[model samples]
Target chain A: MLDVIKSVLAAFFGVQSEANRQRDFQAASPWMFIVVGIALAAVFVLIVAGVAWLAAQ
Target chain B: MKRFALTGICFLLLAALMAGSTYAASINTSTGWNMPPGVTDVSREVYSLHMTIFWICVAISVVVFGAMFWSLFAYRKSKGAKSAHFHENTTVEVIWTAIPLVILIVMAVPATATLKKMYDTSNAEIDILVTGYQWRWRYEYLGEDVSFFSNMSTPRDQIQGLEEKGDNYLVEVDEPMVVPLGKKVRILLTANDVIHAWWVPDLAVKKDAIPGFINESWFLVNEPGIYRGQCAELCGRDHGFMPIEVKAVPQEEYDAWLASRRDAAVAEAAGADREWTMDELMERGAGVYNTYCAACHQPEGQGLPPVFPALAGVGMSVDPEQRAEHIAMVAYGKTGTAMPAFGDTLSPAEVASVITYERNAWGNDTGDMVQPSEIRDLLGK
Candidate 1:
């Protein structure tokens, strides 16, 4: 489970390799990657929001 | 190790930047890094659009690079971090692609609308025919007999470091293309000789002036001021010399100027037939030569040597027999050379005056008076 999260995090930074991709695909279920992807995207939006808020100040 | 060093260096730089300067430099000032939302609706829109994209890119870089640096610093080998190897899944790929799609959709909507408005040149109140020559511009107002060739008015002395340069140097012209404020002016662009692009960033109008083809663009002036631009293409040797100056004025003033311009044209036509004195011929010829010929032969009649023959006292035109040949050369520009034929371009009187000026001004005293009638005969008019 931790491996899935780390792999998804690396992919979020857009530096994932084919080997990591194959490992993630061969995992028991696909739900872990989806959940982590959404989580990372949400983090992205939140970072954008926080920076925008600070800039507005 | 490399990534660790990069993140460390980035943080150090950021720290130095934040701690170093209380005087934060601003972008996009009059002489700075930003576009002026000029005093026109279209230009304002362009500026807004440009700023929106600029900020968006800035925001993106900040977020992406911030997260990257954070991860790099936190996951360094020195920090006892071990590399984890895991790759992409189908669901994550789809979401990543879709997120970018959403952002693009948001941007494309307004961008398309602005582009469509810019392309629509319909229902303009005035039409100005802008023809680009080799290194000059000719503006002819449609449905008006007011037309003139605009040339670079900056003297060569300043350009060659012989005199002090003025504030508006190189950007000034003998005649400016005048238009009225709050009126949509459609510019029909074409080229007389080669391809040139008329570009004025403040007005947000740029179109190619291509030979044998017409391109169209339009702009409505919202304020009264002088806006300048240049031929934004490589046309010839003197491409940098040609500049476009647009003077926007109130409607009433524009009408008065138009009337005066028409009157001036009539007065010039009347004077064409008037018998001119040696002094008058010399003066008029100087003006004509400086406009057309001086670029090659030079202002002082001392041509640029072998390429452009010297017309000074001791040059070929000083000889009695070469006088007729000089007239023919000016009238029918020598082929296989850079000398442009002015027979079709210059009026009969203009050709006569210029020849008279050249022969007399430099004291190349053949004392030869070639009448306008003589030039007309050679032109077979």
Candidate 2:
């Protein structure tokens, strides 16, 4: 799970090494990455919205 | 020598950037260059956001073009350099995409904040319903019983180039929408005929006025001054003629102005009750005709052919027997035609006068006169 979160965060930034890409693709199922990516995306949106709300205040 | 050349290039770029910043700062007040840091807090924030994003783009372009040019010159054919064939280089692609994504996230932060502030139109002190017509704007103060139409005050001769144009040639209006300074003024926008946009740059309020749909926008003026804008949408032939003017005054002055406007509206309503003489109706009718009717029917009563029929000594005007038909045509316009019903747009007095004027003027002398009371009776008002 920790490795999956790390890989998803790297993917969110669009920055992943060749070794990491090979490892991620070699994994049996993409379900882990997919689930993690979606969860991280929602968190990213909440963080941005929170910052905006604070700045407006 | 190569290192020296690179250093010289960097120095030149730095100098150019410095000169540009100085020039932009100096020309901030000039209308030709850059967006104005407008009179309200939101407007100023918008301006700052614009500049921040603009500078980010400038920085990115500098780095990108610099690298591109340096690589181009350094690896030219003259230097015995050979091109490498590569596709889908993951590292380079990732770096490029990652940098842009990060930059976009940074840019979106402030923009979202400003957008939220702009959309928060709650607790506004004044609410005005702004309705757009074919070539005019009608401002109705909510719960204030003060409503009036603002028409362009620029003369026709200037437009035709027969007379010299004034400084505010196309931007002047007969009556401006007045607001109190330091108070939030929310405007509910809609259109009676077609889509039109109300835009005032100083207050940074621009929103569309669509038929059967109401859009909400708000502005709070920081300073007391007159700001002018025009209909930002192209609705019809006379789109360029409709202008918007907003005057921001102190609270007490605004109260006084609103009171005076209420009195004027009362007086105008009273005009409908009295018996108006022919001369009185004719004079008022001519003004109304020029403002509302002259766009389709020409100033001399000879309208454009086919699309707009001539009103002078022809059609319904000359036919004394078709008097009621003429009145009905003016009051409730002909369907499936460009002639819009002035029943809702014009007052009873105005409709009566224009009809009376069309019957009497342009040698269509039927010696006919329509009264406001008769029109009121016909409309059951």
Candidate 3:
């Protein structure tokens, strides 16, 4: 079970890692996904709030 | 590097799309979108706020796009560059988030202040009730004895490109909303039937006139000029044809115009008692019908199918009693129908003339001339 989880994680991250290898660059870290997701979610929330406020006006 | 290039391409494509869609006449437009006369302080503030935001957007776009393009070219993959391995810098993420938050805060403060000012409509100098119909605007100046309907003056021939376009072209109107300059004019907007938006970009105000609901806006123009706008909302097929033109004249001129209109209305009322010759009425009535009724009922009294019922062979035109009802419907539009009451839009003479024309046109001669006095009586009742 542990091995399967590791493989799944590797598959998700390793595809982009392989692409990076072909380009002779460092693989994108998993933390980048978390950071980007947080940023995008923040932007989406702000946009929705702004739109709602304007509609109320 | 590839991602940056893709973003750059996407931005360029979006810019081209936006540039392609803007109206040709709006380009090199010197005067701000026509501002109606008698704009209030709030409207002027809103206009200034809009310009401020627009300039801010332009500045942001220039900075952001400039940096993006510079970065793309400076650190492109074509230069055989190796990607930086350093990632997950907590400080950098915090900085980016903090900067954007600060920028939003800066933008929100003034916008909120302007918005708060816009909502206050108390102590208005002049109160005008504006009612939006299917494709026209009606105005009633409370306590001013000034009420009228404003319709698009652009000829169908010009609109259909059947004739040469005039100077104002689509922006002209048969009757414009006239207001005194340098006075705070308050407008209470409502709709007779469907939803229509009263928007004048120069005043930087657009509010939906919803049926059974009143929305308020105010404006005061510093200069006197003819300001034009269109029905911003899509109401129906003739939506594009409904235009709004406001003639803001000096206070003295406005007063004189108002007096003349009142006198003409009184004279028309008195003329109803006198017997009018059919030849005179028909000639006068034709012009009246063409201006007020032709937009929907049509020039030939053949209305548009599936919506506007035909007035030519209709029972309302043939029978005398039904003719009165037709006049009533035209004077005070029937509820739940496209027929708007012309009571507010047309003068007594104009209404009488149009009704007389409708009764006589298309082989349906009722041999009756609807006098302005009758309409005035009907309106009073």
The predicted structure with the larger TM-score, 2 or 3, is 2
- Residue-level lDDT of model 2, residues B204-254, one tens digit each, is 888999999999999999799999898999989999999999999999999
Q: What is model 3's native contact fraction?
A: 0.00
Tens-digit lDDT string for candidate 1 (B21-53): 323224344454566677678888888888778
Say which candidate scores most in TM-score.
2
Alpha-carbon lDDT of model 2: 0.89
The Cα error of candidate 3 at residue B78, in Å, is: 4.3
Ranking under lDDT, best-scoring first? 2, 1, 3
lDDT head-to-head 1 vs 3, winner:
1
The full ranking of all candidates by DockQ, starting with the best, is: 2, 1, 3
Worst 10 residues of 1 chain B by lDDT: B20-29
List the pairs of residues colliding in candidate 2. none
The list of candidate 2 runs beyond 4 A from truth reads A1-57
